[model samples]
Target chain A: MEIKTRQFKAVARQELNNPNSRIFLDLLPVVLSSLRQLAMASFPDPEAAQRLGGIIRAEALSRLPELLEQFEKNALKAGAKVFWAGDAHAANAYILELARNNQVDFVTKGKSMVTEEMGINEVLEKNGIEVYETDLGEFIAQLLKRPPFHIVGPAANVPPPEIRDIFIEKGIMENPTVDPRELGYAARLYLRDRFSRMKMGITGINFAVAETGTIINVENEGNIRFNKSSPKIQVSVMTLEKVIPNLKDAMHMLRLVSRNCTGQHIGAYASMDTGPRKKDEMDGPDELHIIILDNGRTRLYQNVKTRQALQCIRCGGCLNICPVFGIIGGFPYGWVYSGPMGQLLTPLLLGLSGCHDHIWACTGCGACKANCPAGIDHPRVLHYLREMEVQGEKSLDAVPPPFTEDMAYKAFSVIASNPTLWKLTSKIIRTVLNRNAQDGKLSKGPGPLETWLAGRDFPQMGDKTFHERWKEIENNPPKAVLEN
Target chain B: MKTVSLFVPCIVDLFLPDIGEAMARLLKRLGLSLVYHDAQTCCGQPAFHGGRNPEAVKLAKRFIEIFENDETIVCPSGSCVVMVKKHYPELLADDPAWLKRAQAVAERIFELSEFIVDIMGIADVGASFSGKVAYHESCQLSRELGVVEQPKTLIRAVNGTELVPLNGAAVCCGFGGHFSVTYADISEALVKEKAVHYIASKADLLVISEPGCFLNINGYLSRNHPEHKAMHIAEFLAGKQN
Candidate 1:
């Protein structure tokens, strides 16, 4: 992903106005939210499930350094080669070199956001290696040369006709078809050959248990299963914060992720690999390579307030319930992550320079916080980010807002503090506004009020302040006022 | 008799003083002695939520000083009540004594319907309105203040009123103080979506508890769908009773 997050206004305007995108984004969150609620009924204690999910992630992040070391030692002991990459550049380079060492010119990849974050597909293609995205959404997205629309269901909401055309253009379909099952079959057939011949399989680790040297990948389609075992070598790329304290916590997180994501009790397949196959095992990879990348995660871990960002399990629940995401979709986020999590991560990881747009885009409705199974306080973090941005602590690339916006807030603060000042200011503004009022409403507004009045009528200000009206009658002021 | 201090929000004081007057009339009818502090101004919510905490602190402290001695504080807008209850303590966290005072003041502050139903134990205030009425769940009231049922309970208590459930009623109306103008496109889309849902409900009038939503939703309705009517819950109940 190129960092066009700075162009959020233009991108969001386009997405908001596009009928196709609007229809899909509007319908997705409502459907996802309802499914999640219905699935939540199956839990003996759903609230406890939510709490435990958050606690486990918090525990993992608090002891991340120790847990990562423990996970590395145990994974190595279990016969997996573990490599640590400090950032996306190193992670991409390490994976490219590993492919060269394994004598592979092509690799099969499952649904891995880490790879996307690392820009691994572009890196491999540039270096003369064929990379095939096997997740049905990623596959279609790859064919279309577009980014995923939603985190869980990347190509899920894409129009069937467009996908049908893409499939026909790629020679996957003999004829154009809009049926999803037919399209799935076409993609499966096209991808099966690549799966068999690809010597290296790349995957994303959903959770790495520190108690045992185990890495788990949860998915509905079995692309991850084949991506891990159908090849001579497997490379799993994960961020360092994905580790959990134990297998018990990992199981709890799995249940939460499944229900919150697709409203399923469990994903169809959960591949938990301790390491490469032992001598007795059959149909497994000969070598297991786990790449744990810490791309700007440690900076978050060091900050007390922002460390909460690391607790995200990538369930995409926040995106499914977010009103903004429901309106404009994912591409406007301008990065691998989207929605509340995207708002937090983009500014933190990509730096505020190119990504403050989405961060500022949040309405602070707290819907994401309520929907998050991890109980991540996204609105609070967003407010903090906005405050930081306003303070100019980050993003030297960000241009300052017009003086009117800043001065308005500053002037409001002064007027809000003193009743005398507020009364005088309100009187002057109201008198002016009322003078211009037409038929009990200000049909046309001046300055910034134009934006508000453009869509809605501004009601005429009242003739008298509440205080003035209250004082007209002979009444005693509050006892509290006299006491003060 | 209950003694109450009325916290008149800046908007209510300026554009919609009738809401505050209606709230006062309702409180009086309930045998509550309401005191209006002439010195009371804004709740600092506009500045506080705008990321101007230092400036908000002056108003917040002034607010605490004005209402600290009252038995209870009632505000017509849930948006202001949320600012007082949730953010005041945070703004004053650096000063231990002020934080304690803010926490205390927060405890006694309530939105009108919450004070009426939860504190006064009066769901029915002897009001009547014969029509389909839909309630817009103001984000600060419903989500931030957790006063979801209080407003609906009061609305339903009005005789001859048929409460209609609105789709996406709990979603924001995009009156997020400065957000309406700052992010005009997104804010416009949200309010328009809210209006569409309200229109779909086929309600005769839309009722709301927070002034911000009352203004924002009604503003859109007046411009785009003038056939629709929206009013503050205080005005609705007070008008019927008086």
Candidate 2:
């Protein structure tokens, strides 16, 4: 997928006007968030439950290298082949080689953001191995070649009419229909054929338990279950941070993930794979390959602060609660991740140069922080990213802000530090801004105010600022008698 | 008499000074002595939000120097208070003396409603309003400072004022300091949705605890639905009988 993080404003404006997306943007977030609130109420102490999730993730990330090694050792002991890939190319190469060695004509896949991040499907297709995304949303998104609109639902924002067109074009349905269930049924039939005949299946791990070397996946759809069971060969990939210390931590994370993602008490299926099928097993993969991909994550982990980006559980909780994401949908994020998750991670993974706009788009609202089960302080992270961008960091490829912006803040600091200067500057600004006033408001102004004035009338600067009016207010006697 | 020093935010100091005056009146009416520091400038929120940490640190030091001596410091803006209470310590972490001052000053500072209900233990300030009103929970005030019920407690105590529920009341109004200007399109969409929810609520007025939110929401309201109005919580609770 193309990186459009730089085109945030353009895509956001386009999405704001697109009625098809507007409908979903308005409904999905509100519904999901409210449902999330209700589901979280089931916890004896919701806040404590959320805090525990954060503690678990933080502890996991803190001991990430050791946990990964332990997980690899235990998985290897369980007869699973554990391959450590330092980057995306290595991971993709190994998977491709495995496919070629097995002489697999086609492969089925479960919904996996890591696979998408690696552009694994494109690589496999380019190498003449067909890849089928069996998750319904992923299937539609793959067919349309669009990034996931929402993390949980890849093509969720795509209107039914558009889906009907895509389904018809792809021969997923015999007749045209706009009903979602009917479309889903059509997709189910279409993908079921691939699931049965596919020799290999690929999936992303939600949690790789270090204690038991078991990989767990929580999903509403059963495609992942099929991805593990029906194929002769199963390849599950995870980033270095996915390994938790034990299954208990995984269970706690599972509760938070399900409740936060779709407001369910739990997902429809929780599948765990310790290794490939035993000789006595009736239905399971004969060969299980577990690939742990780093792909710059270790570089991120080297910095104590940036390591928080890996704490994200891919639950889409932050996306649901984010007000900015609530308005523009996910296209403007211009990456595999969107909302606060994308805003923070994209800058780290893609570098600050290309993802500058994503860092500054937040309202500094702590909604994402308050909602996150992983305990990531998104607003603080964004602030840190912004600081890095303005100051420039060689390691992150963060270039210092433009001369004009740098100078503007410098001037601001000077004026703000001195009260006399602030008071004087306020007077001059008041005089200049009031010139554009009509009916006590400025409908138009210069520079930064121009964008604001386009949609809302700015209040004319007060003639006598509070600083100028303080004496009179102080001298006046109290107006109301205390009613105690 | 307990003296409460005022830390008027730059926004209230410039475009919405009436909020500052209203805060003074309400505090004075509650029998507290108010002191306005002539040398107090800003909490350095814009600089901080702009990612200019050095600039923010300079202003944070200046803010600390001005207000650190006061026993109780109060502000009408939640974001400014958040800058002082939350970010200041972090910004000044490298400097031990300033970090200590920031932490000390942070404990004494409070948002208006927070000071009133939590500190002063006053819910009713002999104020009255006649019509239905809904509170727009400013993100900084409600989430950051955990000042959710303080403002509402004061509003609910207003004689004849019926506090109504607002949809997504705690969501951001999109005036993220520089965010409103840089990402104007997304900001407009969010503020528009906020206005839409306010109008749908059928309340006569919307009350906000932060001046930044007041500017953004009231700006949108004034332009599109000029008939409706949004007031700072200080102004609303300062005995403006509507």
Candidate 2 TM-score, true structure as reference: 0.98
Poorest 10 consecutive residues by lDDT, candidate 1 chain A: A475-484
- Work out the TM-score per prediction: 0.96, 0.98
Q: How would you encode candidate 2's per-residue C-alpha lDDT over A16-77 as one tens digit per residue?
A: 88887778777755788889999999999999999999999999998888898899899998
lDDT of 1 by residue, A1-484 (tens): 6667877888888888788787777776578788898887788988887887888888788899999999999999999999999999998999899888878999989998888899999999999999999999999888888887888888765788999988888788897789989999999988998987879999999999998989999999999999998889999999999999899999999999999999998999999999999999988799999999999888877888788998998999999887778878888887789889988987888777677576677666788887788879897887766666666664323344567878887888777767788888988888778877998899767777889988888888877889888965226432211110
Q: Candidate 2: where is the Cα deviation over 4 Å? A: A481-484
State the fnat of model 1: 0.56
Candidate 1 residue spans exceeding 4 A from truth: A394-405, A473-484, B240-242
Residue-level lDDT tens digits of model 1 in B1-242: 77889998888988888888778777877778878888888888777666666778888998999999988999998878888998899889889999999999999999999999999999998777889899998877877888899989998998888999999988878777777777777888888989899899998889999888888888998988888889999888875322
Positional deviation of A277 in candidate 1, in angstroms?
A: 1.0
Residue A104 alpha-carbon offset, candidate 2, angstroms: 1.1
Measured against the true two-chain complex, the DockQ scores of the candidates, in the order shown, are: 0.49, 0.68
